[model samples]
Target chain A: MGVSVLQPGLATTVQDVGRPGYYNVGIPPSGSLDQYSSLAANLLVGNAEDAAVLECTYMGPELRFGSPATVAVTGADLPPLLGGEPRPAWESFAVGAGEVLSFDYLRSGARAYVAVSGGFDVPAVLGSRSTYALGSLGGLEGRALVAGDELPIGDAGGAAPGRSVPEALRSTHPRHREIRVMMGLYDHRLTDGGRRTFAEATWRLTTLADRTGMRYRGATLEFRERVAPFGAGSDPSNIVDAPYPIGSIQVPGGVEPIVLHRDAVSGGGYVMVATVISADMDDVAQSAPNNTTRFVEVDLRPGRRARRRRAARLEALREALA
Target chain B: MSGAGGPGAERAPTVAIRSPLPGVFYRRPSPDFDPFVEVGSPVEPDTTGALFELMKQFFEVPAGTTGTIAAVAVADAEMVDAGQVLFTVRGS
Candidate 1:
């Protein structure tokens, strides 16, 4: 089957789970910022959890299918339409040959995932189909989908019947703007007042937010002039160089928190004070500009358990649909 | 000098450089650009010797020591570990 792009959204690219085991080479595991949503979309169409899907940021793309296929839309609800009629999200649906698929303005969430059976037929780069725009690799020509681009869709045989996401899983989709963070690698470097201000103050998302990192504009966190302390195993540091992970929060000059995301760099000089827990990263990804965010710290043991529980529930939901 | 935390009681001065965050290390700014600094180059405390570009943002590594560059440990366009040595400088 084939799919043609009529209008590519603000930035739409194919993404999977991400490329791993290359962080030391400075290549981030660029993939879906919201893995939960991406997996859900794929599972809706009976595709593997890591299948490539169309990731639409803010605005979405317009496309036409060449052959009948089963597809699903997950992540932030973008209010998609199939052939001029409204299409519901978080469930599987069928599209016939020569049908047009369009999306309107985002109703909620910063991005949405579109998964088709057999997945998007895109070349994988470094073991992933996710696009890393800076390196200019992966996805459609290693960049965002453009108008007039034709994408081949693999045929995963015939379509399975449609399925719905469980009510419990659906309820967990984050609508609030609050983002939970573990106190960062440099949490101690900041004065008591600085730490309190960070926890208490409400910061608005600046236009600086993007796939690489989210920059907040609000109270500036200050630190003692001496070199800030470094933390162990993926924690932040004052040393001008270090490896970075998705959800790593870096504070430079003791002010303004930058939350790294899917496309974030491998290392740098800022003090990473906290890391957003995995379970809540989707909430951070779907945050729109101007949304207010507050950071809260949680211990790692409990945080890991929460992530496992969420993952198990999502898997159970996918199995139910199957 | 003899007071609490005074000069006479102070520990020896040792320069320590650490990784700012985790990312890939590029010695030069881009593929075509020359490296920012080299061995024996005079560096101030704030001079950026190299850069680590994560995602798309570029974070510069400041010369933490005011001296002549002594050794270049990491190769150009290499992956560096957090707290790994990139260079050494001998204080003037």
Candidate 2:
């Protein structure tokens, strides 16, 4: 009838595709970090592409099923264990009543999504189950799961046991990844060397990653010498606060670029040198600390094309499972 | 896991301590502190052998199985991936 929390793991939360159309109102779209993987988990479980699922961080949860259930684990390479037996990722499986489900250590990627039959049965905030912890909005009270909490299970209707996603279509997270970005907005503020280093040098993801934003370490960026503009701060990287687009990369103090994610502030007063394209953002979320990432700049056409390719793959995934 | 390298009450002859996440593995608690466990050191299932750091947070690498430190697979402050064995313990 429900999943009882034996151990809540590192950080597990209920999330969906996210609450769109409200960024203008200062509400960050706090959804799954890896959207494609989230969708696949949901699809395998016979839920909608955007159905709510649990996003587990470095460690995973220990749960006992109160009743028969269908489940799927996707995203990170954290393999699921049922009654101490290994279960494959990216596939649907069955759990008998009273069976315990846990996970192994993460092998690749940073987040893992768990999709249950029917879904989380959590109430949606603003038409979505995503959690925005900063605002304390949505998804099981808008925070990470804790021990002793019981989660209601949705009515089961997802794929049968042994149904799995195609390997080619399944996304994999590598230790080193070249993420696509679009430069602009404040590239003029950077000195020529700064721009070159940003484009040429590799950056390492820092543990400063969460739902709000992720930080990276690398060569320091230099800004063009300029007097502080009205409403702008004295730091060369400071500017009149502006709305921050999701995936915008802001470097403060000329070092450690921060990429805003699904649960970031709506606006900020920092100079944004680049924006990670929509299609590749999932990869950015999956990047673990110590993982090297190079921001590969791309044109608008390529960005849009990447989005289309993702949509096509998802459509094919639905068919594959069906 | 109840058997075959799983962590449980029954101890295996040798226990493998692995990093659960990718990060820098620190043998000592701090630069000034002594290493958590050295070779031949007795340890319990819950005993921590090392610290794995990532994103500025520290996670303890527990023995998970009771034994004595048999070998250190990684050096102090070495970067390791998840599932990478960090140390081995010989059980009673």
Best by TM-score: 2
Candidate lDDT (C-alpha), each: 0.76, 0.87
lDDT of 1 at A196: 85
Query: Per-residue lDDT for B60 in model 1?
Result: 90
Which residue window of length 10 is worst by lDDT in model 1 chain A? A228-237
lDDT of 2 by residue, B1-92 (tens): 23323364235567688888777899988899999998878788898889977756788988888667878999898777778889988775
User: Candidate 1: where is the Cα deviation over 4 Å?
Assistant: A171-175, A227-238, B1-92
lDDT of 1 by residue, A211-317 (tens): 89988767877664563345432323366466777898887655568899988988877777788988888788887555568888789887888789888977787
How far residue A173's Cα lies from its native spot in candidate 1, in Å, is 5.6
- TM-score to native of every candidate shown: 0.73, 0.91
What is the DockQ of the complex in model 2? Answer: 0.47
- lDDT accuracy of residue A270 in candidate 2: 95
Docking class of 2: acceptable
- Tens digits of per-residue lDDT, candidate 2, A162-257, equal 778999878888889999999978889999999999988899887678888889998999999999989999999999999999999999988999
